[model samples]
Target: MGMIKDAQVSVRDLFRWRQRTVTVDEQGNEHVTFETPSTPPNPIRLLRSISMLGWGAYLIGFFCWTADAFDFHALSIQTVKLSQHFGISRTEISTAVTLTLLLRSVGAAIFGIFSDYFGRKYPLTVNMWILGALQVGSIYAPSWNTFLAIRALFGLGMGGVYGAAAGMALENIPVEARGLMSGIFQQGYSFGYVLAACTNLGVGGATSSWPIMFWVGAAMSFAAGFARLIFPESKQFIEARQNSKGSSTAQFAKNFGKMLKLEWKVCVYSIILMSWFNWFSHTSQDSYTTFMLVGKELNNAAASRASILMKTGAVVGGTFVGYFSQWLGRRRAMIIACFMVCCLIPAWILPETESGLEGGGFMLQFFVQGAWGVVPVYLSEISPPAFRAIFVGLTYQLGNAISAPSTQIINALSDSHTIRNHTGRVVAAYGPVMGIATAIIAVGLALTAAVGPEKKGASFESAAAATTAEAVTDISAAAAPSKAHQSSSVGQATSEEDLAGKKGANGDSHAVLTKTEYA
Candidate 1:
């Protein structure tokens, strides 16, 4: 014990964790240290290496996505123009959109895994460049085949962008700022939609050729690509890379293994919640608003205004949704969002006459926009870094896939029906169905809320903040400490220390809950 005390005084390891002392005997020597398990940390933070230039570059990626969304309705309506140029049937032209979605999902899966391997910046920049090239090629597609292929190819880039961008965002920001910052970042599309609407509205959608939209897409994609060319790899990605050995392949598999270990029940519930609520929200809200204008038989200007108003409202609503989530909690916020849609859906469907359409469109867009923002913030909080990219890709692209089919099915149903009294009420007809579906899922969520969403303030734990000094003080109170020198335990403290590190500062970085991360 005498020799142990001296050696312990200058031991192999000394950590301060909360306010506790830990002195253990090892190899006939005393090892003394301190550790603090519950010492709340300063918050996770990123170095300011990424300046405003990086943000601008990062933001342009979102702009490309937004432009595509704005062009969707116009493109769908431009079947005649598209058909003439593409030399295919309406069905074939439609496949361009459908396949784009399908392939985008595939791209997300591939690149999401790749981002976990190759680093976020390079993949993101490469994808942006590809998107730009495709957008430009799309501008001059000589036939339907060429156009369809280009669009489908573009989906790969688009898909890659989502996960890579998310990975990049989360990789750089402060831990405490993660929730709110991510909330904002995820809602970029809704805001982008507003920008798209403004472009269309300002330039006059009818006067503008459809090709201009792709030009817009190309420009934004190129801008982002060029800008990100200079950005650094995410620091988090670097840390993850360091922890890894052998091959990126091994790490990826390990990540997948962790994801597989996730509580199956939680996984299922998350998928359901994401798919049902998310799909319907897009279908019921965005699709309806655009279609409602056409249904109202309103002139071009009024139609454009209606679209503009709805998306503008969406932008405003999305921006504030995170604040609401902070108070109500993510799960409850989701529940309330669905409930809000259910109640307002009636209003959306029953605005009665043309004049009332504006009010209906305005009211429904609020929830549609707001509910979406809450989703990203909630999911990221639950995801751990290891598998965040994959889960983000899966949930987001999967949800989009569900909605894409639902959109097709609803369009088929609407055109199939004929009601003399319901002549202009076609768009509204889909609302209650979506609202009902959402409500049912929302109920299941409330029932399993405990398992699905993560604890909001739980990011307080940072891996870096755990130290030996604090650890030793907390343990010393037992006072009757006696242990024969036995074995040695390394004080590397990988997992818990990282948790402390994550507490650095919260920023709106993209955090998507990957099953691996959750595990």
Candidate 2:
């Protein structure tokens, strides 16, 4: 009931224009105040603030991310065909998905840190190339063991893409436009799903034709990588480099250690939040095509069409909710979307006719991915300025790792359960199982979001500048006492003691600072 009311208020807030003002107090604490606005900022003018180079970086990032999604979904949407081709149960094929998700965290940790220290260009380009090559490699795998090995390798490449792509895409955009752009950027995943479904529809359901989709995925990956090669590094990254002292292995390690020590709570919270979100998406979408085919008794063509429609809804919902989040607030947007999903569950999975199933699938995914659309910017806002790429990628992929078994769990449970099909034959109860799982996940996600921290409208550039200034101040302070002693020995000792106390006080303040106040 409380959730329903919040959802209502969230919807109402979308239509009401409001102005948010940030004020800093004497202690440097920020207070946010909101009021009714007579006129809102022009959306078109807001968009024009992004430079041509910013658009290029965003597009390349979106394309690379889309290509990665295409490669992964190609296998997932073709689960039945792959199962037949490999002469294994659908449950066994799901193991490959599990393995892929399980290894993503490893890649995220490696490539995320590398991207943070060096730049997004080299690490992201290499990851895309690796993904393309692996997509091709999967087509020629002789045995199930070899196939799983390729998929596990694919996860590593896939994991690196999200952090690099998200950082490059969102970092340079104006804060006012980030919500809308984030929505559009996150739709790359949904668009990739749509593309995979279209490809499946074109190639037909023959087990032999699965290789064609892989070929297409490989081509897309390579194309995205090549496109990125022509673009310069992200503007924010370039500015950050200019203002910093220098990057090195030792400096990076020290920074990373300090971040972990000071920001461990945020890190843990993000991982938990991401874990729920990953499960929400995976459990709802991964086996959806299979559910349509077996549970609804739809033909491959109908199932593929329905899958396309479902993801189309995801694209639209993500965009709308993402834009709305700018005014409604990130946490509110997510909470509302999650509660809405709970209401749509019955429609999502219980419909008997193809059109009914289509409508249900579309509406459910609309809200599901709508919540997801806020994720990129929300994660970016809370991330430490210097380690945006690594922090965003590692937390997200670690959550992916935690929820890696969603598909397998769904398949295994559904296989064990039975239901009567239209033909009156007992079949895996995919629909009911998925519906129940989605409801639980949606509720869990909503509750988690309700209690979580938000750093909406945080300024990344300012944070970076503050960090640099603080470092410089520390250096100057350390060197000051050595230059001259203008006091007696007793006075010097007292001044030294006071300085130590001040340092301790500053350390405590730094330790307690929120992600938005990191500097």
Candidate 3:
């Protein structure tokens, strides 16, 4: 068929398949591309629908972040209470907090892999339940070991939720909203932190009423997870599933292989950025200022309040960054955020007299911390659609893996200075070193971000086209019947556009459909 006549067929095919690729299941042991179809889009309605999904995913991020804030610190305060009850030393009780963060990274990794294989919805829902369960159960644990072990297990749920959520966030939002949504997604951590601090203060004092904190997390997780379960799966993941078949967990491994073959750039990006983003966010949000303020003679209430202010800044920065980055594009927004990091971090160490002084405590806690809204947006924009769930999980967990151990080390190292009260003295002692370390980390990230940054509010298909087009063609070909034809070039053609006339699952015609590699 010629271009014009084929265009009409393509339009109908587009509507029929909705730009989702089609494949064939060959006895569960093998697969082949049945056909490739032209991009299908109800651009107007699709955009709106996707935007709604973005919002829903954003809510997921919000809920997860809030839960983490509640749960992440579960060990910190609970260790104090449980230690008194169980007669364990403060250091020994510390395992509850430490292990939780550490173990959650495993959750993120495993669940992330599951999300890739099973799709994002189920894993996401399950993770929420885990969080809620831990909150409810941890309140009444009989032994210190059991309490700590369960709390650590909760981290796994926390780990799995976001990367999958990140996948959904990208799919649900339109190309235009990618940057903003990314910011919104990433902002969850900071917002969650703020939510935690405020919740702690609101729900009776932690000193007398630490158990209330767990109750609050449980309640929120239940409500949100319940509401969230009704939300739709990421169209991206759904589309991918429909194009392939057979529910065996082994397919998960196969899909990862496809992902590796198709989108290695994204994988590289995930690994590289994961370290910086995860470590810095974890270190700063979970520990630093609280430790410093406590060391400097600040009361728990005052320190908690300071944490609230800082995390609130992060929330605000993220919420605003989401929309703002939509206008600016992901890379530029990230560049701006990177510059902000460079600017905000050095204040951590300056002498009180030398430091800007008046709001230095607040600045370190909130402003510097608040600048974290950059990561989600970047990751969301960069990932491949087919492999999103898996990649997000992998990259995010990879980051967490690096951060989890590092946070523990930071805790161990900083434990010596013991910032019980005075905020000033604490900043004087540890703030500068942390600030420098963070800045160095930021600069290193800035270098890798040299991938010329993505433009905001453009066609996602086009953005991913160059990277994914060939893989799409190959995967489609693999599922095709013997009739599928290729350009007779062994990828020596230098461009995917050269290949033509491929049929996909429903026997649709498309320009990109050549032949599946396995087919």
Best-performing candidate as measured by TM-score? 2
**What is the TM-score (0 to 1) of candidate 1?**
0.70
Model 3 sits at a Cα RMSD from the real structure of 10.5
Which regions of candidate 3 deviate over 4 angstroms? 1-61, 76-95, 203-208, 239-252, 261-265, 327-329, 346-358, 361-371, 417-428, 451-519
Segments of candidate 1 deviating more than 4 angstroms: 1-94, 202-208, 242-248, 262-267, 352-355, 421-451, 458-519
lDDT of 3: 0.54
Model 1, residue 123: distance off in Å is 0.5
lDDT, candidates in the order shown: 0.51, 0.79, 0.54
lDDT of 3 by residue, 238-355 (tens): 5545554454545445545665764454465567667766666665555554443434444455556666666666666665555554444334445456667677664544433322
Model 3 residue 152 distance off true place after TM-score fit, in angstroms: 2.4
Ranking by TM-score: 2, 3, 1
Q: In candidate 2, what are the lDDT values of residues 313-384, reduced to their tens digit? A: 999999888988887778788999998999999888877888888899899999999999999998887676
RMSD of 1: 12.2
Better of 1 and 3 by lDDT: 3
Every model's TM-score: 0.70, 0.85, 0.70
In terms of lDDT, which candidate is stronger, 1 or 2? Answer: 2
Model 1 has a clash total of 64
Cα lDDT of model 1 overall?
0.51
The full ranking of all candidates by lDDT, starting with the best, is: 2, 3, 1
